[model samples]
Target: MSALMLDPASGSSVGLLVAGLIVLVGAVVQGSIGYGLNLLAGPLLALIDPALVPVPVLMIACVQAALAVVREHKHTEWRGVGWAMVGRLPGNVLGVLAVASLPLAQFNIVIGVSVLVCVGLSMLSLKLSPTRPGLVVAGAASGAFGTASSIGGPPIALLYQHSTGPVVRATLGAYFLLASISSVVTLLIAGQVRVEHLSAAAVLLPFMLAGFAASGPLRKFLRGPRLRYAVLGVAAASAMFLILRNLF
Candidate 1:
């Protein structure tokens, strides 16, 4: 409570309300498509209050993923998920290393540029299939990028661009479920998980769930090829967002 800068009488802060709205919007977007929560919410939340980020946001993401998994679990590619998680393990370590040792701006530039290049490459003949090796590679890349930049969906989302909407959402939900849990656990081990984090997350969960509920209607409109374009657009936008974020 004190950590959130809440008013004792009201039991909340204006910044927190603003953050909940942002999370709601991000959640709706992510629920309709397969990703975009972090891309949409991370910056805005940081501007509102830096403490709203990372821990609390990640907690909501984990819950959102869990709900998504339940929502479309049947469409998930279980085999691909297993392989991707395997790759994610090592990739997560690499991301930690890069974050600790590399120059922030330069490293972010490379990551952002690489994501953009990958988007461009997808337009060519380098389409990724859901084979074990492809999934593993994509998963590893996602892990590294996500760990390094807190934006992991592009790699996995790109791999599943050609898949059906349900497949894309469900598979990503599963991947994020495992990955988010892993990340939170890691943070806990590092003593980054605190009471304030849980407080913030609790405050935001309702809004997040509301956004997910609102997204049910939007999903119908994003079916088929439209969903692919949406994913690609979100991915490209996130890449640019990352580049711009670090440059300034």
Candidate 2:
């Protein structure tokens, strides 16, 4: 990718403010539910400024994941995380290859459609427990999608949706922490990482953290069935948006 692929976003501007607002809202959603930040922020940021994506967005998201891990450290499923990471490492490689060769529209369309299918199946009472094999597959999918598009939570979150809220949040937090960091490293190696991405992340960090702080109440409210439905709805909505954007 050329250096201009992600335009430099510097200085104070209306666009920056708008981007921060989006980040704030997304952080609240993800902070409360375990996954929604990128699904919510990515498209809007692209519309607002191409420079705000893939790197800057992912950076702040890592921060949110870290907070989740710390808050729910006791609830983390370490064995599950290790199993998923087994697949995630390779999946990240595949994602890098996809970004290197696959057409953007094609890649986005495929991911969106795949995610929608998973959501639809789950809605049909398709019970998917976080088994070792299941976690591996989901982890792989998360790594590929997270690295390729930054929408990695659904595959793993959907699995934990049937479980408790704290488990869902903490497990996903642990898994995504590694995924986001790995994706950034991939970008850095590809020569896609830049100072502008860091600057944009710095500007957006406060708003994202504010959203996280504000989610304390909302998180209390969204639990059990509410959280399960949220996983399905957000995953489906995000997938549809991605598909439409690429198609049009």
Candidate 3:
């Protein structure tokens, strides 16, 4: 195991350790505030190893979403999630095609810029009600982005930013639970899911669980406006990171 954990930065046996710590922190954020594991972990993990993006991080996200759903089951908004998923199916198909055919570097730049622009719009009081149509649009966007980059929570999170904490967490959790399944299936069909992806996820699972365990104590401090700001801040920073990494 030590031989396998070579650090890309220090050339020490701590690459997996660093990745696990990142996952742990991201998981705590996601568990406490709902929706940030991918945004926080995806780019950093990609720096550690490009192959770790989208699939392995997504697998962990699926688990996190599932755990969130179980923890917040009573607050789940089925109607909104249903409509979003209705749009997600087709969007997921399109995303798979994009991943298969498009140039990843260009797509990364486009996605990064798009996320930053959306985050900026959100900060400017761009709010969307969680109506059926709005949910469908958000869901479709989430499916496309998630399938391509594994960072799909921002759109849905933005849509529900003004909602109560439990609702936001529960709805997004349920939505991600379903969406992650769709993404994995699509990736499997696109020949993207491999044993190594599962292996990486396994390696990171303990840290994810640990972070989630820690979140139980931190949830009290991150309510209402605090939660909203945390989501937006993380989203903006993650988008900026993606843009800089791709462009430079």
Candidates sorted on lDDT, descending: 2, 3, 1
Encode model 3's per-residue lDDT on 124-233: one tens digit a residue: 87775788888898888888888998888887888888888888888889999999999999899888887777777888888999998898877778888898888788
In candidate 3, which residue pairs get closer than 3 Å at backbone N, Cα or C atoms, i.e. clash? Answer: none
lDDT of 1 by residue, 1-248 (tens): 23654223445567667878888998998999988887678656766666665667778889999899999999999888899899887787777777678986687778789889988988776876688888888878877777655677788888888998899899999998898777667666756678877877888888999999999889889988899889888888878877887788
TM-score of each: 0.90, 0.94, 0.92
Q: What is candidate 1's TM-score against the reference?
A: 0.90
CA RMSD per model (angstroms): 2.5, 2.1, 3.2
* Candidate 1 lDDT for residue 202: 84
For TM-score, the strongest prediction is 2
lDDT score of model 1?
A: 0.80
Q: Which ranges in model 3 have alpha carbons more than 4 Å from their true place?
A: 1-12
lDDT of candidate 2 over 3-94, digit per residue (tens) = 32233333446776788899999998988888899998987787776666678888988999999999988999989888988888888888
Shift of residue 54 alpha carbon in model 1, Å: 2.2
Candidates' lDDT values, in order?
0.80, 0.85, 0.84
Model 1: colliding residue pairs: none
